[model samples]
Target: MNLVLFDLDNTLLAGDSDYEWGQFLIAKGAVDGPHYEAKNKAFYEDYKTGRLDIYAFLAFALHPLATHTRAQLDAWHAEYMETHVKPMITQTARDLVNKRLDDADLVAIITATNSFVTAPIAREFGIPYLIATDPEEIDGRFTGEVAGTPCFREGKVARLERFLEAHGTHLDRLGSSWFYSDSHNDLPLLEKVQHPIAVDPDTVLHAHALAKNWPVISLRGDQHA
Candidate 1:
């Protein structure tokens, strides 16, 4: 059996969902527009350069979840799906996912974005498995705390191992394994796979992909591979 992992935010979608979610909230007046956008954009820059402190960013990102009721959050997220996320999805991305679903033994979206934000996106891609950061919850409400390791950078490697362990398998047990990502931040997990594909990658990953002779491809028309 083989494994195929796709990075959700920028790889499968034309844009970054986490950053877009923050923008979405700002547009909806859920957050102080200028203040939130400034911090969100700064964090995104850090992420692109592989300098992000996941904990600090999580604290910022998840706090709004704690302040809102589950019902309200769900309603907003439902609207987010229709307004922000759905438009980000493209036919090429969907086709790539469909191809993997038919060809791979296990296919999952591995993203640093919290499960709350990424779960429905995974379902929209028809991917049955997702490996993402988990936000703490109690009594059907968010606690604005991380449940375990944030699935970012090296944490993605650890999370994938745990996921494989839960299935009584290991990376070595797979006939082949592949990971597709657009960020340099994902280098750790990208390096773990037998095949590391840079999909419309950032400057850093683009250089690394070229140096390592890794195959680079683009699912979105606007991106250069």
Candidate 2:
């Protein structure tokens, strides 16, 4: 069976989940309004420019989990899924994923966002497998620290390799593989896949996709390259 991988944020959703999560927390007063919002925007800009420091961003992004109980976090996330994330789920994105699910034996959402934030999003897409950055947990509470290599840039390949090894399979074992993403940060995995699709890609990734003669699509509108 073929393998299909989808990037969670801008690729499948019309927006960035990590950035929106921080905005949600700020609106809820879980984080300082000005300070948190400023940093969130800065971090988002860094991500767009391919200059993000995953560890540093995690310290800021995961701080809410450390401050609140798991139950509280869960409740907030439920609201987040309902309010922020659900609206971003366009019919086009759903159709794309459903099509892939029907065609592939294994379908997964691979993202740099922490599991705490993305797990439910994956569920919403009906994707059974998720490869996301893990937040350190002690006694069922987050430490606001990353557990392993943050799944950004080259780290995505490392994490996926480890995941495949645990399943007693490798990239070559799959008859064919497809990876859909928007950011240049996902170039490592996109290049690794046999069918690399750029969905609503940013400027850098869009240019790279054109150079590589990869398929470029936009769920936001009727745009294709």
Candidate 3:
């Protein structure tokens, strides 16, 4: 048995998941602000670059939702799925997921995206496990805080270790573990995998991928392997 971990944002989807999520919150009446886009973008950039830990990222991402309850955030997530994510599913990524499902591998999504938003995408792709940062709640209301370690950089490897421990799986025991990502920020986790494939990578990651002699793949037209 093996594990196939995938990154959520540009690796699976076409663009920035957090930005889309913030837009979703604004559209759903969950957050009201003219600065939502700029603020969310800045926070997301920092989080992706590993400057923000899991808790800080969630605190900033869902800070707007702090005015509401967890139930309200859940409902807003539903709207987010329908409004922002339902249509952007990439054929190549979907096909890759379907192949993994067919092979019965333990497919997991490891993303820095908030659990509320990433959960829907995981469900859409029929993934069994999701590792993401959770928003802290007190008496059902968001505290504008995050719970547990953030799933970014080395944090992703830590999250994977915990998940495997709970499931009686080990990193070496996976036999042939693989990870797919597009960000240089994911270098820590990518390096840990036996197979690290850089898919449609950005400038910084692409350069590192080349230097490391890692196999780079693309999901765009006429691209594969």
Candidate 4:
């Protein structure tokens, strides 16, 4: 089956999941103060502007809970999905995903967001595969460090490569592998796909898409990459 990879966040959701997730933590009492929100918001800007590296940005975002146990983080993630991110999935995107599945496409989510956060979103959508940055754990506690490469920018392509290897699939073998993304940060993956579609593209990606004759579509113009 052909692979249909999708970026999370703005491509799938209307807003930044990371910032909202941090807000969830603060609201749930899992984290304290307004610093979490500030840090996450700033990280979004830095990431979009290509200022912050993926690993460092994630570490900074989660630093407040560095001392929390893995179990605690897991519970928090579960709650965050149910109470925060789960309800934010746009109906248009949901319809799109359903249509792709109906076509028997091999669906997967490739995001820079942490696996702990993206797992539930993927599960809710019934997606069987997800490739995201995994946080390190030791002694049943979070180490505040990434276990592997932070799946951002070109890292998304690297993770997809590993996924293909594990599943005995390759890009060239697919009949019509497609990728949908929003941010300019995902340009690497967007460029690698056989069918690259810019969904809710950012300014940089929008211009490139137009200049290259790439498809630029939005789910009701709600995409703000």
lDDT tens digits, residue span 87-199, model 1: 88888888899999999999999999999999999998899999999999999999999999999988999999999999889988889999999999999988889999999
Report the C-alpha displacement of residue 216, candidate 1, in angstroms: 0.4
Candidate 4 residue pairs in backbone clash: none
Clashes of each: 0, 0, 1, 0
lDDT of 2 by residue, 120-223 (tens): 99999899999999999999999988899888889999989898788788998889999999999999899898999999899999999999999999777443
Q: Estimate each model's TM-score.
A: 0.97, 0.96, 0.88, 0.90
Measured on C-alpha atoms, candidate 1 has an lDDT of 0.93
Q: By the lDDT metric, which is better: model 1 or model 3?
A: 1
Query: What are the lDDT figures for the candidates, one per model?
Result: 0.93, 0.91, 0.79, 0.80
What are the per-residue Cα lDDT tens digits for candidate 3 across 68-98?
6677777777777776776566678789888
Candidate 3, number of clashes: 1
Report lDDT (Cα) of residue 189, candidate 3. 91
Query: Which candidate's TM-score is highest?
Result: 1
Estimate, for each residue in 1-225, the C-alpha lDDT of model 4 and write its tens digit.
Answer: 688988889888776777788887778776655876677778888878878677678877656457776678778877777677756677788888888877856889899988767888888887888998887767766677888888899888899988988888877777888989888888888888888999988899999899989999886444321
> Which residue ranges in model 4 land beyond 4 Å of their true spot?
220-225
Candidate 4 structure lDDT: 0.80
- Could you tell which candidate, 1 or 4, scores higher by lDDT? 1
Off by over 4 Å in 3: 47-55, 220-225
TM-score of candidate 1 on Cα atoms, chains taken together? 0.97
Residue 104: error of model 2 in Å?
A: 0.4
